[model samples]
Target: MSASLEKGIHALKEQVDSTVAAFFSSCVHCGMCADACLFYTETGEPERMPINKVEPLRRIWKSEYTLLGRIGKLFGLTKKVDDKLLTEWETLVYDSCTLCGRCSMVCPVGNDIALMIRKTREGMAVAGHAPEGLIGATTRAITIGSPMGVKLPALQAQIRHVEESTGKTIPVDVEGAEYMLLLSSMEIMNFPEFIEAVSKIFDRAGVSWTISTEAFEATNSGIQIGVSDLAAELVQRIVDAAEKLKVKTVISPECGHAYMAIRWEGPNLVGKPFSFKVRHILEVLNELREQGKLEISSRETQKLTYHDPCQISRRGGVINEPRSLLDMVADNFVEMPDTGKMNWCCGAGGGVSSNERADEIRLKVFQRKKEQLDAIKPDAIVSACSNCRLNLEDALEEYNMDIPLLSLTEMLADHLAD
Candidate 1:
C-alpha cells in the first residue's frame, strides 16, 4: 500500500477503536434493540442486524484494546489491517447504514449508535470518503450560508415573491421584535408557501415577528455533512442574527432537520445554550390555538395521513403538536401503523436525500413507508420536514403514486381565518 493510504488506514483504525469502544461500553447487548431496527427486519441478514451492525467497529476495538487481540497479532492469528479492509469499512460506514438510531431507544445501556455513526463520519470525512452530494451541499452552505446556495439578495427576492403571492409584507430584521422567524432554504426556494403560511399565522395572531435577510436560512448542511466546525459556524450566524434583532424567541419554519439543528443541537454545536428560546412551527401554532389566536371553523375536507419526520418526531421529541393541529384541520386523519416516535423513516435521514448514489437504496428502504401510505389511500400526506417532504415526493413519483404534499404550516394556514 502507498504511504498515504497506509496512514489513512491507521487513522481510521484509531477512530474506529475509540468510537466502537464508546458504543460497546454503553451497550449490554440485551437484544431489545432488535425490534426497533428496520434493516434487520427487512433483510434478515444477521450482519445487517442492529446489534451485529457494529461488528466491523467492534473487531477494530477488540484488535486494539484486548489482550487476546495482542496475542493474535503477535502470532498472526488475525490479519493485519490493509487497504482493502479500509475500503470495505468505508462502504459499510457510509453507504450501508442510515444512522437512524431506532436501536438506541431499545438499548438498555443507553448506547447512542447514531452518535457513533456521526463520529465515524468524522473519520470518513478526514479520509475524503464522504458522499459527493453531501460534500457539495456543505460546500455551498459554507460559501453562501445555505445548502441551496441562496444568497442574501436572492433570499430577499424570494421573500418579496412570497409577499406578492400572499399579500403580506414580511419585514426583515425589525429591531426589538418579540420574535425572529427563521426559514430553511427549502421553504424559500422550493416551498415558498411554508414561509407565507408562517407570515400569515403571525400576522393573524398579531404577534410581532421579523425575518433576518442576513441570516435568513435555518438549514444547516454542515450538520448533515458531519462537519462539527462548519455546523457550529453556521449556527452562530443564526444566533448572532437573533441577538441583533433582540427577539425574545425565535420560531423555526416547517422543516424537520432545521428544527433539530437549531433547537436540539444548536446549543451544543455553538458551545453554549442560546439565551433565546427556539420553537418549531407546530409548537407555535399550538400556542396560537391555546391562546385563541388561531380559530379553525372548517376541516380540510380531505383524507390525510401524516408521515413523521425522524428529526422532528424522534430527535426533537415533537410528535403530538403536529398531530393536534392536523386533527383540527383534516376531516379525517389516518395514521400509519408505526406513527409518532416509532414511525419508520422516509429513508432520507443522514443527508441521504441528496446522495444520488444512495437514491435507489433510499427508495427501496422507503417502500415500507410507501406501503403504509398506500394502505391509507389518503388525499394528501403531511410532514413537518422539508427533506422528508422532498423524499416522499420523489417516492410518489417513482412508484407512480399520487399524493399531494403539504407542510403542517400549510394546513394550518388553510384553516386560518382570512
Candidate 2:
C-alpha cells in the first residue's frame, strides 16, 4: 500500500468510534436519506444518497471492527478500501453531499448521516483525495489566516470606508468591549455592506462591540476540509483573541459555517470551553430588539421571504431569532414551505461552493431552492449567511430570475429610527 493509503486507512480506523459503529449497525437501509438529499432528489442518482456517500467509511468499520468481516478480510473476501475506491468516492463525498444535516434530520433510526460524511472526509482528505478547491482554501487559511486570503489591511480599508461613510467609529482590538464581532471572509471581501450594517445597528442600539484584527476571519476551512487539528488551530486563535481582549461575547457574523465552527464546534475542537460566550448576529440583534434597543422607523412593504442557511438555522438552533428580527423590519414577510429547521439547503453550503468541480452540480441542485421560491413568489429573499446570499444570487441570475436578495442585518440597519 502507498504511504497515503496507509495513513487514510489508519485515520478511517480511528474514526470508527462507538457512535459510528452504532449508526452503521442500526441503519435499516431505508431510502429516507436519499429522498432528503437535494442532489439525489434533483437528479435521481442513487450515488448521491447521503448514506451511500460514506460507503468507504462503512467498509472500513466492518472490515476492521466486526468479527465476521475481519475473517472475510483475512480471506480476501471483503471489499478492500483502496486508492481506486477513494478516487471514485471523491465526487460523491465532496461534490454531492453538502453536510447540511437534512438527511440526518430525516433518518428513521436517528443516524447523523451528515456527521458520518464529515468523518469520511477526514480520511479522504488525508488520503490526498480532497478537491483542489478545498485543499487550496485550507492552505490559504493556514498561511494567510483567512480562507479567501483577506489581510488585515483589506479589513482596515473597509473599516475606514464604513466609518467615513456612516460617521461611526468601527472599533477594533478594543479591550473590555461587551462583544467582539467576527466576520466571514466573504463578508470581508464580497459583502462589506454587512460590516457597515453591523456598525450602524450597534451604534444606534448603544451596544458595545469591537472587531479583532488578530482573528477577524470567522469561517474555518479546516472544518470544511475535515482537518480537526487544523480546525482546532483556527478556533484557538479566536479563543485566544477573545480571552486576551476580555470580551464577554464573540458575535458570529451572518456566515452559517462560521457560526457552526465558532459557536458549536470550537469548544470541542479546542479541547476546552471558551472563556467568552458565542452568539450569532441574529441572536444578538434579537436580544437588542427584545430589550427595546432596536427602534425601527420603517418596514419593508414588498413581499419578503427568509432562506434559512443550513448551519445557522437548522443545525445551530437559531431558527426563531432571524424570524423575530425580520418581523421587526418586514411588514409583508412570508414563509417558504418547510421553512426554518426543515428548510431545503441552498445547495452551495458545507464547502460545495468552494469546489469548482461541483459548480455545475451545485447550480443543478439549486432547483430545490428555486421551487421553494416559486411556491412563495416573494419579491425578495432575506438571509443572514453571506455565503448563502452569494450562492442564491448566482443561482437566481443563472435561472434568469430577477428576485433580489437582502441581508436581514442590513434591512434592520436601514430601518433603524432616524
Candidate 3:
C-alpha cells in the first residue's frame, strides 16, 4: 500500500476501535433484541440474528481492543482485518440490514443498534464504501438545505403556487407566530397538494402557523448518510429558524424521516434541549380534533389500508394519531396483519428508495409488505412518509399492482370542511 493509503487505513482502524468500544460497552447480549428483529424470525439464521447482527463489528472489537484479543493476535489465532473482511462487513452493514431500531425497543440495556450502525457507517464513509444514493443525498444536503437540492428560489415558487391554489395567505416568518411549519422537499416536488392541504387545515383551524422559506426543508439527509456533523448542521437550520421566528411549536410536515430527525433527535442534535415543542402533522390534527376545530363530514366509502412509516411510527413513537385521522376520514378501514409499530417497512427507509443499485433489493424486500396489502385488497394505501410513497409506487408499478397511495394530509384535506 502507498503511504497515503496506509495512513487512511490507520485512521479508519482508529474509528472502528472507538465505535466498537462504544457498541460493546452498550450491549449486554441479553437476546431480547432478537425478538423484535424481522430478519432473524424470517430466516431463522443465527448469523442473521439482531444481537448477532453486530458480531462483525464485535469481532473487530474483540480481536483489536480487548485484552484477550491482543493475546489471540500474538498467537495468530484471531482473524486479521483485510480487504475481504472489509467487503463482507460492507455488505452486512449496508445490504443485509436496514437501520430500523425495532431491536433497540426490546433491548433491556437500551443499546441503540441504530447508533452503532451509524458509527459503522462513519467508518465505511471514511473508506469511501458508502452507497451511491446516501453519498449523493448527503452531498446535496450540504450544498443545498435539502436532500432534493430545492434551493430558496424554487421553494418560494412552490410556496407561491400552494398559496395560489388554496387562496390562503400562508404566513412566512411572521413575527411571534405560534408555530413554524416545516416542509419536506419531496412534497414540493412530487406531492404539492400536501402543502395546500396543510395550509387549508391550519387556516380552517384558525391556528397561527408560518412557513420559513429560508429554512424550508425539514428533510435531513445527514441522518440518512450517517454523518453526525452534517445531520447537526441541517438540524441547526430548523433550530435557528424557530428561534428567529419565535414560534412556540415546530410542526413537521407529512414525512417520516423528517419527523424522526426533528421530534426525537432534534434536541440532541442541537446540543441543548429546545424550548419549543415538535409535533408531527397527525399530532397537530389530533390536537385540532380534540379542540373541536377539525370537523369531519360523512366518511368516504372506500377500502383503505394504512402503511406505517418506520421512522415515524417505530422510531418516533407515533402510530395511532394517523390511524385515528384515517378512521375518521374513511368509511372502511381494513387493518393489515402487522399494523401499528410492529408493521413491516415499506422497504424505503434509510435512504434506500433513491439507491439505483439497491432498487432490486428494495423491491424484493417489499414482497412481504405487498403480500399484506394484496390480502387486504384495499383501493388505496394511506402513508405519511414521502420515501415510503415513492417506494410503494415503484413496487406497485413493478408488480403491476393496482393500489393508489395517498398521504394522510391529502386524505384529511378531502374531508375537511370547506
Candidate 4:
C-alpha cells in the first residue's frame, strides 16, 4: 500500500468507536438518506447518496471490526480500501456532500449519515484526498489564522470604518467585557456591513462586547477539512483569547459552521470544557430583545423569508432564535416550505463554497434552494449566516432572480429604535 493510503486506513480504523460501530450496524440501506440529500434529489445520481458517499468508512468497519468480515480478511476475501478508492470518492466526499446534517435529520432508521461522512472525511484528509480548495483553506487557517487569509490589520481598518460611521468606539482587546465577538473572514472581507450592524445594535442595547485582536476569526476550516488536530488548534486560539480577556461569552457571528465549530464542537475537540461560554449572535440578540434592551424603530414592510443555515439551525439547535428576532423587526415575515431546522442548505456550506472544482455542481444543486424560494416568492430573503448569504446571492444571480438578500443583523441595525 502507498504510505498515504496506509495512513488513511489506520485513521479510519481509529475512528470506529462504539458510536461509529452502532451507526454502521444500524443502517438498513433503506435509501431514506439518499432522498434526504439534495445532491441526489437534484442530480438523480445514486452515487450522491449520503450513505453511499461514506462507503469507504463502512468497508473499514466491516473488514476490521465484524466477526464474519474478520474471517473474510483472513481468507483475503475482503475488499480493501486503496488510494484509487480514495481518489475516486474524493469528489463524492468533498465536492458533493455539504455536511449539512439534513440526511441525519431524516434517517428512518436513525442513522446519522452526515456524521459518518465527517468521520469518512477524517480518513480522506489523512490520505491526502481532500479537495484542493479545502486543503488550501485548512492550510491558510493554520498558517495565516484565517482561511481567506485575512489579517488583523484588515480587521482593524474595518473596525475604524464602522466606528467612524456609527460614532461608537469599537472596543478591541477589552478585558472583562461581557462578550468577545468573533467574525468570519467573509464578513471581514466581503461583508463589512455586518460589523457595522453589530456596532449599531450593541450601542443601542448597551451591550458590553469587544472584538479580540488576538483571535477574531470565527470560521474553522479545520472542521470543514476534517482535521481534528488543526481544528483543536484553531479553537484553542479563541479559548485562550477569551480567557485572557476574561470575557463572559464568545459570540459567534453570522457564520454557521463557525458557530458549530466554536460553540458546539470546540470543547470536545480541545478535550476540555471551556473557561467561558459561547453563544451565536442570534441567541445573544434574542436574549437582549427578551430583556427589553433590543428594540426596532420600525418593522420591515416588504415580504421577507428566512434561509436557515443548516449548521446553525439543524446542527446547532438555534431554530427559534432567528425567527423570534425577526418577529421584532419584520411585520411581513414569511416561511419557506421547510423552514427552520429542516430548511435546505444553500449548496455552498461545509467548505463547498471554497472548493472551486465544486462550483458547477454547487450551482446545479442550487435548484433545491430555487424551488424553496419560488414557493414563498418573497421580496427578499433574510439569513443569519454570511456564508449562506454569499451563496444565496450568487445562486440568485445565476437564476436571474432579482430578489434581494438581507442580513438579519443588518436589518435590525437599520431599524434600531431611538
* Backbone clashes under 3 angstroms, per model: 1, 0, 0, 0
lDDT of each: 0.76, 0.93, 0.76, 0.92
Candidate 1: tens digits of C-alpha lDDT, residues 150-216? 7888778888898998887998889889888888777778887887888888888998999887687
lDDT of 1 at 145: 82
Using Cα atoms with residue i matched to residue i, what is each candidate's TM-score against the true structure? 0.88, 0.98, 0.87, 0.99
Candidate 4 least-lDDT 10 residues: 105-114
Candidate 1's C-alpha runs over 4 A off are: 1-22, 26-35, 40-48, 51-83, 107-110
How big is the positional error of residue 276 in model 2, measured in Å on the Cα after superposition? 0.9
Predicted structure 1, TM vs. truth? 0.88
Off by over 4 Å in 3: 1-56, 64-67, 73-77, 80-83, 103-112
Backbone collision tally, model 1: 1
Per-model C-alpha RMSD: 3.2, 1.0, 3.5, 0.8
lDDT of 1 at 400: 92
